[model samples]
Target chain A: MTVPAEAARRRIVDLFLSSEERLLQRWTQLSGASPGELRDLYQALRTALSSEDGDFADVRGLLAELSRARVRQGHTPSDTARLVFSLKEALYEVAEADGGPEALRGFVWFSRLVDDLGLYTFESYTAAREKIIIDQTEQLLELSTPVVKLWEGIVAVPLVGTLDSARTQVVMEKLLQTLVDTGSEHAVIDITGVPAVDTQVAQHLLKTVVAARLMGAECVISGIRPQIAHTIVTLGIEFGDIVTKASLADALSYALSRSGVEITGAARTRVAVRAERA
Target chain B: MERVPILKLGDILIVSIQIDLDDQSVLALQEDLADMVVSSGARGVIIDITAVEIVDSFIGRMFSTIAAMTRMLDAETVVVGMRPAVAITLVELGLSLGGVRTALNLEKGVAMLEHVRGAAG
Candidate 1:
């Protein structure tokens, strides 16, 4: 590199090594980070600056770890970046006290390095946050699709939320698997919790029904709210001979009757008569 | 070349496919099934595929082809015991096997055939 820049780098490394403890103390006080967190980062920074190639790999590694910890602690991205940037202020205080033209030049070089490290921390923080979001989304997908047995020969999938291609795929796979496991001939897909039903969603529903039929089970879609029925009719989407019921109760009874279950009201009336006599 | 065995249970013919179906085997099974239906005068046919794992377009069409052949011979064909993955693959491949009937298992398949017979009578 240029001769003056090389001299400036060396002068900064010397400053870091001379008063490492005091610089770390100032960093902790300025950044409001725990002393233990700042100490490891300070040592890594010193080692990186003193190295022949000035490779800041160790400093970056330490910053990434710090970023991950701050992310877990729910700290903001700026807060994590400021922790790295504050080290520059601590170093500047030392450089100013050890004043020389070379120290001033060295402070400029160090400031640029810290700026790069600060941005690196920000990048690491964002990456960690993205991982958390992806993990939560996967969990939510699993949680939302549940296949429950409604009767001896029937099962129901109570679907909630907006139906997307990915979520529909999960629901389809899970429903089909449950059908095979339960050997239930009837499945009622209850979409009461679904907010909307566009053509794409209707298509997914049709595919699921077709898949289940291929597995030798009949699917009855329930929870067709008034608005969704209007939308479906407006879109000219024909549910084609597949049964659509207005409520889960209707869907369940439809499934039961299809399976040859005769639900008589005699038992309910008997209980009602006993209550009246008492 | 492995041959899929076709068993006669009363008036119903049962073909349980337990082997991976290559083109040759599939074609052989189709020919053998058609012959058995005609010779035995079976009223119904149940093709059980619970033990089968994969089905491509050829094997899928083989199902429809067999169903149509049996129907022409005055026998009803009901495919039964299809695995979920296989069913989903068939659907995604756009081979719904529309003309053929399906039941969840062997018992259900037999029950469905009886129900159809009872209704027809």
Candidate 2:
């Protein structure tokens, strides 16, 4: 196959050799270095880079093939994860060096690779890498377009998608930082916004709530859709063990209730009765 | 850069924010997003960054302002799709994001709005 565009091809050769040498050494230590495995890794690298035929599908298909090939060839799940990670780590410098969206386009293949592996292998490592890109991309725009600082009470943050360690760390930090700055006593994360539920993401949600709670701001999760609930159940993710709700409103209402704030409409009678006793 | 309205997700509206939010754009866009939120009766707002690169402090402050106003209006706001280096730089610079809500992506921000809509008034 024709080599990648001049710059990308150069990057591949420069980075791939060190990685290959390391992989060969590792393999040699693990068993005996087979020339075929070494050659296969080289081809795998080439295939991954070459798959981008000015058409996006090429790299994606290559990732799928490499994942299966890695597994069938007895490369541990972690091995494949590292392969993806190293590619990113290598490209991370490339993007930083080049500094443009064009630089980031190469990453799409890696992103697709993460999705491909995340679905097939069901590994946390792959998920974490995906979160890195997502988090970075999310951080680019000021989501606070309609920004506000609450002088008091709770403001909810709904977290969705796979909350890998990198993302979980950001989620916990940003939410707590917001609560502190706003002086809000409650920060709710409604999972109903989440399209998928896995044990890792669920735990990160739990951790976020716990972190908020530690700051004296109670965290409430709402919007547990039926499908998400089922996935949580199958995945053995236990929200019953943590503080969560079925919907964002419930979570907000729960927060309001916890803060001793009464919604004046339906609870007017109860408020009157309590006032009378007081 | 010119700003364009793309899609609506409940009270949360997505704006394809054009031009990097620098000092000048931040001033205008703050008023722009706030007015839109109020007029649209959106409980939340997301500034899509698929095209943006840099978010200087002046613009960062605008985000904080919009977030504060949205809270006053009883709505939430989320900033979506920032680059990694941008995030790192913002954090390292001891940036003042104020009380703005941040989401990982557009879909999550929209989904968060549903929770806000469903809650008891």
Candidate 3:
């Protein structure tokens, strides 16, 4: 290890092990990122710092460009998490080929962030966004779903977009996290937006709602929008007593009204909308 | 773009805009409307924006400018037929087209202008 780089690594290790309050406080300001997430960021910064070549001044410019791209795209909390995860993974892949002690040490922090902090993958980011659509549909005060509390209560989130095994797992985790955050009782997951649901998507959603119910939250599944729903039913994939609503709105209202929130005005609009569809 | 129309309902000049109502389009519309108000000698101006689905924050900030132009030209202005969804979206998107007199429909918009003039007299 080079003198200064090794010293820097030793300092980071000490700060991590000693629970340095000042170091923690300073990192808290930069991104307010989770501790493990911050560790990932630090590792990413280390990679950018180490592999950076050419003019001594060029490193700042490269980072500036990356930051601009992030800002332009409206990077959210989840976006930051996925970015750190990718950077960590990429650094480790490169480190395996190069096999330098300093680079490997940097890889260690990034890998630890993923392992210890429960950070998700890039594909998981897409899955979360797709799931957020379910959140959006639930927030709608549509006819089938009556009360305003549907947005605040336990509701089903159908998976849409790509749910590779990696992201499917993250979606399951976030669903449980959101159930806890919202304190909703029932969550139904419909897999309509998912390009297709294999055994994995079905299994992931089932596991997620079960986890929620274990936490005293009820779960529902709706938005099994037509084709996807038909496919699952045809496959004889019994969803194990998981309530299925035709749509998210239907599921949300059923969940809320059962919880004693009367959804009067919303029901009429929902019917009227359906009648108009006919 | 040239997609927006500068229509005339008798002495009332109606400036109708469409598509995303951002700063560039608003500036172009305001400039054109000002010229139309001057050359056409309009006594009233009706700005219809029912077609706009996405309005940028900067577009909302141009309202007072258009309002001031109408006043200087001695032509009263009324905005007509902004859908509730569009309004809510605009507000949520943090665009406030404040001080622009709005009505439910074109008829109500015309009525508003007449009402304002009658009150003035």
Each candidate's TM vs. the true structure? 0.85, 0.32, 0.32
Q: Give the worst 10-residue stretch by lDDT in candidate 3 chain A.
A: A140-149
Proportion of native contacts found in each model? 0.76, 0.00, 0.00
Model 2, TM vs. native: 0.32
| TM-score of predicted chain A against the true chain A, for each candidate | 0.88, 0.43, 0.41
Question: How many clashing pairs per prediction, in order?
Answer: 0, 24, 15
| Interface RMSD (Å) of candidate 3 | 18.5
Ranking by TM-score: 1, 2, 3
Off by over 4 Å in 3: A1-278, B1-3
Docking class of 3: incorrect
1 or 3, greater by TM-score = 1
**Top-scoring candidate (lDDT):** 1
Per-residue alpha-carbon lDDT of model 3 for A1-278, expressed as tens digits? 57856654554343333443443444545444456545544544445445534122333333333444444466664555554444444444445555557656755654674443223333344455566676665453221222123455554555657666556665555555555445454566656566677776666666655444433456677766677677778877778777778777777668766565564445447532111110
Candidate 1 vs candidate 2: the lDDT winner is 1
- Candidate 3 residues B16-89, lDDT tens each? 76666656667888888899899998888887776756545666556667887888889887766554345534
Q: Residue-wise lDDT of candidate 2 within A1-278, one digit each (tens)? A: 23444544445444434455554554434433355644554456556555555343444454556565555466666666555444445445545565555445545545465455444443443544566577766774334212233214667666655545556556656766666556565777765556776676667666555444423346666787898778878987656546767777677667666666656657436532122111
Candidate 1 chain A lowest-lDDT run of ten: A269-278
